[model samples]
Target: RTVTSKMDLLAFHTNTPNESLISSENGVDLSLGSQPLENTKVHFEEKQFVCSECGKGFTHKSALLTHKRIHTGEKPFACADCGKCFTQKSKASVLKHERIHTGEKPFVCLECGKRFTQKSSLHKHERVHTGEKPFACSDCGKCFTKKAYLVVHERIHRGEKPFECFECGKYFTTKSYLLTHERIHRGERPFTCSECGRCFTEKSSLLTHEHCGSAIGCRSCTTGILTLLESCAKDMRPIGFSLSHITYCC
Candidate 1:
């Protein structure tokens, strides 16, 4: 008699005194010798449910339905405060955004006691103490603590300035620079001098004004002061200049 199934093979092996046996199953022949049955690779779960949009396969129907949201752009989970939508897979994104309104920092670092709104932020912050830089640039082999830092470093090698200012059509390497440039177009002077209540578009300009106490030293500050002086001359206003009292002239 021929063994067609694994159970039959096992039972035949136990009863028979043969050192080897030939078994056939699903049109495939198996030579069962002195090798253990545990060594055989037989078990497998087929992915029956397949995505029509991306052609990705999943073992369960629920998983396939969840993955379909990526192609459909369906975000069921939304924040009540901001009404910002997020995918079901990223339910944590909604929670993180909610913490911004609540000012809740649940994740805390044990080493430094620094609190973070998200667990991922806490993990990234812990790297500062651990000195572990996993993300490395392919071109320069320079390692960075965060993957975002590594991505920005790689952009320098590729000369990719993705961030652009819509008002002036100027490109910037980083989003922070683009945001600072946008402040000029908006006439927003957020950085204020404590001494004179003077506002500046950039933090560096504020620092320079604080250090020099006058616009005479810095080039950008001098240009701005010259323009203001030109306006004062047109108005027939007398301007007095001094190092300690620079606000009197303006």
Candidate 2:
């Protein structure tokens, strides 16, 4: 039903199920029927949804797109202050985007006292204490609280690292990660921890530090994270992400 190339969508049907046609030029019109349904005439109203219904309403389709951040779990609206991402791609994309211009840490974590711009991010950060593993891998016995970490874990099983940097002779599992690593050379660190006054080159590094601090850090961070995987017996004793009770030493 779907092709990799461009195609047009066509619509046809009323009250009942009907197929639509595809046209390259003319956009599909999703209009309601004029007929009645069980002694009830079709209202055929503009079909304008209310704000309270969808959480909020926007005047433009693009505005509606911005509104959809409340759903779909998309954070196109990223925070410059703390590198937190939001799903809603805003009209004045400049305002939200510019926050990144000035490093801000307005959003704070009540659990750990870490600050962030996006509430969703604070929620994710808090999971470290709660010891949550909501995202699990079907192929293997592994779990992660964050979707991004799950993706990175999938890449490990897939044995894929798409980005290779020529300058540093370093390879990265993802493009954005590789780009962040490049900042080390550029010295473009925008995130700093308030408690210890430790600055990080990448937001990801900052995130990792929150969980895996050091020997003490990894020990504490993995405490909550490790228990979640014990039932699987899949052996999460890998290098950076997990710990093993026994070390080969050979």
What is the TM-score of candidate 2?
A: 0.38
Per-residue lDDT for 223 in model 1? 39
lDDT for each residue of candidate 1 in 1-250, tens digit (9 for 90 to 100)? 5556567666776777464555453433334554455443352235779999878998789989888988999988777788787767465666688899999999999999999999999999999999999999989899999998988889899999999898889998899989999999999999999977989888988777777564433222433444433334333422343233333232
Clashes of each: 0, 14
* Segments in model 1 whose C-alpha atoms lie over 4 Å from true places: 1-43, 89-94, 204-250
Best candidate (score: lDDT): 1
Give the alpha-carbon lDDT of every model.
0.72, 0.56
